[model samples]
Target: MSFDYDLFVIGGGSGGVRAARVAAQAGARVALAEESRYGGTCVIRGCVPKKLMVFASEYPGAMADAQAYGWTVHAGGFDWSAFHGKLEAELDRLEGVYRGILSGNNVTTFDARATLADAHTIELSTGERLSARHVLVAAGGHPVRPDIPGAELGIVSDDIFKLDALPRSILIVGGGYIACEFACILNGLGVQVTQYYRGAQILRGFDGEARGLVADEMIRSGVDLHLGTNVLGMARAEGGVRVTPTHGEEKVFGAVMFATGRVPNTAGMGLEAAGVELGRNGEIVVDDYSQSTVPSIYAIGDVTDRVNLTPVAIREGMAFVETVIKGNPTPVDHALIPTAIFTQPEMGTVGLSEEEARDQEPVEVYAASFKPMQQSFAGRDDRVLMKLIVSRETRKVLGCHIVAPGAGEMIQLAGIAVKMGATKEDFDHTVAVHPTMSEEIVTMSAPVRTG
Candidate 1:
């Protein structure tokens, strides 16, 4: 069974890169191909750049808080060009690092796209065909615009980073994390941000009380959010993007961005033609071990539509290498992964939601909501929440959710405890960190309500 290479990885995303690198390190002949940037969506257009924007957006509030703390701090208008220049440079460094990782590990790298020609052969856009013992599809996804007249006029999350300058105003059209995070980002940068979501609330899958508080804070922070509203259509107009909403008068803005959803990047990849099963969204269908129906073909990361997080993708890649390359069968653990949403009042959560836990079994919920000393001393009305969903019978912490400043950091540590199956008594036994918002998680003595 001699092949051109032991592995030909399609799509140089976090997952594919990891698989290629690790497999090569394990003495396999591995090669990877990417059509675009080496770092894929997360490093290039996603969390990395978005987190930088989040940091940039937070400066205004920090300055205001400084003023409230009696420091003579003054701020000026945000210079989008300056920040964007640095952002691009940092991304370039990261992309180069990813490239180095592949080459350093002795994995042949291709700057062109690759597709499955068969269970064992890969066709490249560079007019080269190669065969491999295994093929890994890690091609990520692209943000999609809603179907409507003049939809083309609306940009996507990818376009945000490429903007020459920040728009004076933006009409964001989705309630997902991307839309809401950008709404907060652009609003903080002094953009007249108006968001429309046809849903009843933003952050639909999160805890109800947490999302409700976030919605309240978003409104208080001046995002013109219109729930149960959608854009009927969009067209270029005098100001920027003329949008006709499902429920309101037509208005114009400097730009309209759609963050509705993303479709997997398996189109025209010859997956199904080669007898690879695909889901409704064109994602490659894979088993727990990331093996496709065609045993020689495998998929991971967003292309497989699994966990879809960069860390999860990396884990899937590691598991694939363990199973196939090392000859040790391994399955990815998809449970209890923690996530953070960079909204105005950030969200950090792990495990099941209160609503979800309630549906499964009897649970006790311990929660605290109050203004922290820092924000309170600044005279801001902002408040934070800490909550735990505990199983009534097993006494295990079923879920932990936090909505506050640095909730992401808090949740990462809290997630460790939850992942270890810590119970309420375990948390209760822990002492509180005095004067800190997270201390509430430990200090809450009684369940606010038990189901």
Candidate 2:
């Protein structure tokens, strides 16, 4: 069939942009449309800005630690205006880079929302209708505030980057990674941060011991964390925002932010009319190959709700291009993904949790909790944890979880070994790096508990 393009990509997110570029590079005609910024969530309002905030928030402690090291380091208060300005500039540059990549790849771009006009046609908000041989929906997701009275008074994670000034005190709601990370980030940035989670503990899906240490550390680090507590309502008061909780009386805070949850961005996109099956959360339903019920259409990224991380979305995009454009079949792999949480004390984890591993097989748990040399030497009471979950029958490391300052960096290397199916013996065979926290991974000889 004669079509205007071989691929019409909706939502110029990391996934959509990648698919469009790869398809075009493979000698296929490609067009992409995005209603918002080119760099999408991760670059524009998510991981990039959040990481910068994490870095900015760490300077105070770094300065204090420096002083303990006998280095005279003078410090000034965090200037929100300055840091936010730089963050905006960096986002602008990144967005430009994304645009440049698409243009350089000879992919047509439209700065307008694109919705499915049919199985193989896209209707742009600009009153343009284009037909393609295949359509790729890579629309991402957005954070949602919980349903409650005066919930509008509370901001989501997106609104954090937009605040002109950081509030003196914030009542944060939710206990997921976003909530925990922001709880840590705002606390470090010198905000009087109080977090409420209805659950019994924070970081629900992570290893129990690891999350336990995180919660304990968060409490010790001066976070007013209230687990098994939830906000009933919110209202504006003379002070700031008045919050009513299930467990406590009304309290006032400078702001109320909801890191409660996120939903896929799939509404009003004409996806239903075009025969694309959507999941319970309005997420597009796709198979292992990312192909929607409609053969001509495919979905990726958070829009599919299949591993919502940015890198996973990019990989899904690559797989889509390889399968559809390059005549190579590739199914998106969503297993054993290593993830890092940017909490006050960072967390990095991969594979199954000890609880999860034990549920499937007999396992040995090896764990250590101690104050690291650097922070201990600085007289900071902060402690770090290293844990390994090994399959008793196979002697393979089923899981590796680390809660330390650089756990994110440590996890990436550990992830490589775990991905390669490294056994507990394989780790023991490696030489330990002296005086390093990570050496604990290799130095632990005996299983602390074999079940």
Candidate 3:
């Protein structure tokens, strides 16, 4: 009746660590396996390192803006090698912290990859086998490379942070957040940056107006955006890489980066041996409670194709412990999860877009667009846009989206309100915060309902 462990978790990323720690805290014996550093993509490459570069890239603008405030600087320069050094040091410190947290919780850590040997057993790369009452896989995902004629000439997200030296010019492919954000960062860092997206606009899934405004702003800030262009392939050329698109001119750059998409890292994990179902994208198929086809098995986070954000993964992991281990029967509510993109001007949103609202309910859209107050003094031409979508019948707020400085910080409050079913009237009734970018949400002018 006693199992080798209470829970065996594969992949010590956000979700796996959270699940292991929570289960262990609840007095369950837990074992966790990770092949690489504990913090996974967010802490190592995808989010954390990318945002750090974004932060570093913004200083030039900040220094320029400081001049308007009567600040003077003699000399300024950016050294890519120095930035890389700091980034690596910080990442190493973080990896140690992740390892400490797991070990401190008494969750046994195995520095090896794991494959499902059977329904109840996991075979480790070290030739060790472990059995548990339940098995949880949160293996996460990896960036994908498209099959082009000379695709190997280009790099993906995994290689972006590892660049030895910054390129003089870079060509970024795809319209996702990674492409958009990196384009802004490199452009701000004085690199001649060109971005290519097959769609008419960047940020395909965002609100139309917001997407348009972001693309326009990025272009104004010196990003050459080539929209509706298909990349044919890439090849090594005279000075660097030559990228040829289907409908556009051939562009040459010091480096090429493809931020196309990511697929779950479920291959060779022996899911078939365990009888677990998988989606077409290779994501683990799980029900509402994150339980796989086999009740004794569970999956969470990007591996499960749920919300791929780190916070959502952590929530799902904790929820799993509460439901499966503690018998509390917790189910995750995925609706209205707030997300932020750390591009130049930044953006944040929760709930549904106006287009999505129309598919579900009659929506009353309220929107406000204006130059931020800082622009009044700093003389910057950029503007901030905020929109609120409300249900016509119920008057409940259906969505909130914004583009500006502090958009991410502001959206969290709105996310909490939306999660609690706050109505349009409730937002209007709330007093506006004075002289703040966020006040625009509560004080938006009444919009004409097209429906």
Candidate 4:
């Protein structure tokens, strides 16, 4: 049957926007609706603003390093208002760009929320009903506060970007990257930061050695990190948030932020009503091609709870376009993704963790941890780590993990090699670029440990 549009996309995040734009460009009539800002989490609240804060938070340490380098640098207090003003402006510009992209692609845009009226129809918040031949759900996810007394007193990751002023002290709860990263960011910004993780170690799924180093560095850098600890309850006190932990005495802080976990944003979207399958976590269940149980309905990105990274979402969107519009039947690849956690020391990892590698097959680990020249000369006690996990029988590099400054940038390049299935000999054959932290990746000749 003919419909009003070939595709109606619910959500304007990176994935939805890209899918809508690409499909429209392929000559399919398209429409996209967003309840909030256009750029979605990554650009509007998640990565972009957080990274800017990461940069803003590093100035104090940069000033100290500047002095060590014989430059006369006078560091001043952080002006959150000024930095936040500029941040908002940049976000506004980005949102406009996203809008421009949709408009330029000839896709109809709606500023209101959209939900499924049926498998082939969408109902917008504005009482407008539209039908489409295919429906794409990319509604994304949201950070949720834990179920505890006075939980409302605490804020989530999104609330971090909206604070009018930085807290003098914050008790950040959670051991995930978001919790650890913000703890480091606030500490760097001259705030008294205390982090509590219920788990034995932070970054639970990452390489044990890498996360251990990060936890140690965070403590060394003045973050009051308490492992195997959790907040039992909270109360609004005269000064700030009075927190009672599972193992510690009650204490007060200017704020308490919870990075406990995130859940799919699928509430009231009528997925179940339309016969779309959802996971226990409210995530839309989808096939490899991002097609939901309903043939005409599909989901991608965080909504599908598959590789929730922004780049992954964008890739899924592209794959969706290729499969649906281009008739290429492309499947989204969710393997060997390289990721960078912007903690104090930073971590970049790709492929299996050492623990995972050892569990699956016999492996050799080549590792080195030493003070880098720049940080050493600056009189900093900071040390960098480079490690490779290689399959013993296959001689293939199973994983590469780096912990140091610029690990993010280094991992991006390293990821390419690992993605190509580079072997130990392949890495060994490459000449080392001396006086570089990453050269260690190529120059490590012997296994520190083999299993």
Best by lDDT, which number?
A: 4
How does candidate 4 fare on TM-score? 0.99
The TM-scores, one per candidate, come to: 0.99, 0.99, 0.98, 0.99
lDDT score, candidate 1, position 156 = 97
C-alpha RMSD in Å of predicted model 2 compared with the true structure: 0.8
Compose the digit string of candidate 4's lDDT tens values, residues 361-407. 99999999999998898999998899999999999999999999889
Model 1 over residues 187-302: C-alpha lDDT tens digits? 99999999999999999988988888888999899999999999888888987888999887999999999999999998999988899999998888899999999999888999
lDDT tens digits, residue span 2-80, model 2 = 9999999988878889999989999999999999999899988899999999999899999999999999999878899
Candidate 3 runs further than 4 Å off: none
Please identify model 1 stretches exceeding 4 Å from their true place: none
After superposition, the stretches of candidate 4 with alpha carbons farther than 4 Å from their true spots are none
Ranking by lDDT: 4, 2, 1, 3
Better of 2 and 3 by TM-score: 2
Per-residue alpha-carbon lDDT of candidate 3 for residues 121-203, written as tens digits (9 for 90 to 100) = 99999999999999999899999888888888888988988999888999899999989999999998889998989888899
Q: What is the C-alpha lDDT of each candidate?
A: 0.93, 0.93, 0.89, 0.94
Model 2 misplaced regions, further than 4 Å:
none
- In candidate 4 the C-alpha lDDT for residue 47 amounts to 96
